[model samples]
Target: MSGPELRTERLVLRRWRDADRVPFAELNADPRVTEHFRSPLSRERSDALVDRIEAGFEEYGFGLWAVEVAGSGEFVGFTGLAVPSFEPPWGRSVEIGWRLAAHAWGHGYATEAATAALDHGFDVAGLPSVVSFTARTNVRSLAVMRRLGMTYDPADDFDHPVLPPGHRLRPHVVYRLTAADWRARRTG
Candidate 1:
């Protein structure tokens, strides 16, 4: 099932391409951009990530999209949904996430792209609910979660299994939004 292309006010969400590597690698290399999660990714890792995203597009039909500016056509970053690897408070739930180039920050692009992705997840994918999560100290992502109308689930917070036992980033906070919650937010 091929995913349909989606658009926001000033961006286009499409599948990854070979030519997207350089821009995507650059985005991954930015320390500020990857501060929330792990360290900066090497070019090789970034390329591999693009490949993984491509495969996800084919397998899941809705995965992290290659986000580009409509006018400049710049590959800013990606924003969409994926199944979280860690066992979560929501059980096995789809996750909504985003990562933009530093230059793309403060311009509402993350929110714009994510809003559209959420719409697609519910309307097209027919998902019942979606979850978004981040490090406990990642205030920026937390802010975006709140902006997306997600409610904090402190009881759901847990140590990320992928991280080492003593890792600072192991602890995570999760937020949830159901189809009913989304529809209410839409109408309100």
Candidate 2:
């Protein structure tokens, strides 16, 4: 199914394609890219994730958009909204997230793409708020959350249900952006 596409001055956020699989897999397998995760993804697992990403769009009319550079059409990575089905406190929440290739790092690509996704959730989907969570040690991601105007409450931090108890990455911090806050930021 065809999904929504969003364009920025330098990037295009759109549906996945057959051509994106290889590079997408490479991105997922990169050590630096997946450093904060438990481990890098195998090709088989990477392919499965693409299938799920595509299915999300078909089911929800929105999902993580495959991101590419606007002028050169380079496949960077993905950034968009997702319904994270985890556990209590975070289950069934709309989340904005992203993953870009190592080459795309430090270029503000994540911030740009994620802002579009957050805007889509707040303006198009009419969501009340969107949340983003990452490992407590992932300072880069936390920076992006801040750049997107998401606020953090130390009390909202929690252990990720999917992660093993006592795992190094289990502790995560949540950031939120409400519709009212988004509007005020945009029009104020």
Clashes of each: 0, 0
> Per-candidate TM vs. native?
0.95, 0.96
Best by lDDT: 2
Name the top TM-score candidate.
2
Residue by residue across 1-188, what tens digits does model 2's lDDT show? Answer: 57789999899999998999999999999999998898899999999999999988888888999999999999999999888866647566888999999999999999999888878888888889889999999999999999888999999999888889999999999999999998898788
Give the C-alpha lDDT of model 2. 0.91
Task: Show model 1 residue runs off by greater than 4 Å.
Answer: none
Cα error of candidate 1 at position 8, Å: 1.1
**Candidate 1, 141-168: lDDT as tens digits:** 8888999999996898988888889899
lDDT per model vs. reference = 0.89, 0.91
Residue 162 lDDT, candidate 1, scale 0-100: 83
